[model samples]
Target: MASKMASCIFCKIIKGDIPCFKLYESDKTLAFLDINPLSRGHALVIPKFHGEKLADIPDDNLSEILPVVKKLVAATGATEYNILQNNGRGAHQEVDHVHFHMIPKPNAEEGLGIRWPQQKTDMDKIKALYEEIKARM
Candidate 1:
C-alpha cells in the first residue's frame, strides 16, 4: 500500500507533493478541481487511502466522498451533474486510485457525455443472475 501510494498521483497531491486547486479536505477524503475539466466546475473527490478501486477501500475511508461531492455541487451551484466512479480500465477508469468525478452538466455539449448501449433483456437470465448475486450478498 505504501509503495502504491508513493506512485499514485492523487496520493502525491494529498501529501502536498503535487499542487492542486483544493476544494475540501477531511481526515478521510480530499476534493479538488479537475485540471482537465469537462465543465466549468468539474471536480474530483478522492479517498485519502490508497485504493485502486471502490471495493478495495474501507467503508470508513469512503464515508466522506459523497458528502464532499454534495458540498461541491452545492458550492458550485450545479443543478445538473453526474457523479461518476469507474472501477477498471475497461470501465474507463484512467487513474488507478479510487476517485469520484463530480461533473456539472451545464449544457448538452459540456460535462460527462455518455451513450447507453442497451442490451436485449432476457428475463430468465436476469432472474438467475439476480438470484445468484443476492445469495452471495
Candidate 2:
C-alpha cells in the first residue's frame, strides 16, 4: 500500500487531477502556489515520490526538491523566505506526504509564525540522551 493518500490535495495536484498555479517543475520535483497561502507568494515544493516523512524519501528525490524551491525564490523575486518541513502530527503536519513550504516573507508580519513554549533543559538528561543516540548510531 502507498504511504500517501490517493485523495490527498497534494496528490491531486501531482496527478493533475486538480489545478494549481505552478511556479516550477522538473523531472522529479514540483513547485506550486499554496491553495491556502499564508502570504502572497506562499508555495510548496515536493518530491514526485510519495513519502510521508522526509527521511522516508530517497536521497535523489530529496535532492531534486530543493532546487525547485530555490528556483521559486528567484522567480518570485522574494527577498526572504522561510523553508519549513513539518513531520508527524505533533509537528502540525496536515498533509501526510513530505513537502517543503517555501513561504515568502516580504515583511515581518506577512509570513509564518508560531508560539513555542521554551523550557529549561536539564544538562544531565541532555548528555544522557546524546549518549544514547550515539550508542544507537
Point to the candidate with the largest lDDT: 1
**What local lDDT does model 2 show for residue 43?**
92
For each predicted model, how many residue pairs clash, with residues at least 3 apart or on different chains? 0, 0
* Candidate 1 error regions (>4 Å): none
TM-score of each: 0.97, 0.86
How many residue pairs of model 1 clash at the backbone? 0
Which tens-of-lDDT digit does each residue in 21-42 have in candidate 2?
9877777888888988888889
What does candidate 1's lDDT look like per residue over 1-137, in tens digits?
A: 78888999999999999999999988889999999999999999999888999999999899888889999999999999999999999999998899999999999999999999999989999999999999999
**Deviation from native of the Cα of residue 133 in model 2, angstroms:** 1.9
Point to the candidate with the largest TM-score.
1
Model 2, residue 54: what's the lDDT?
86
Please give the lDDT score at residue 15 for candidate 1: 95
Clashes of 2: 0
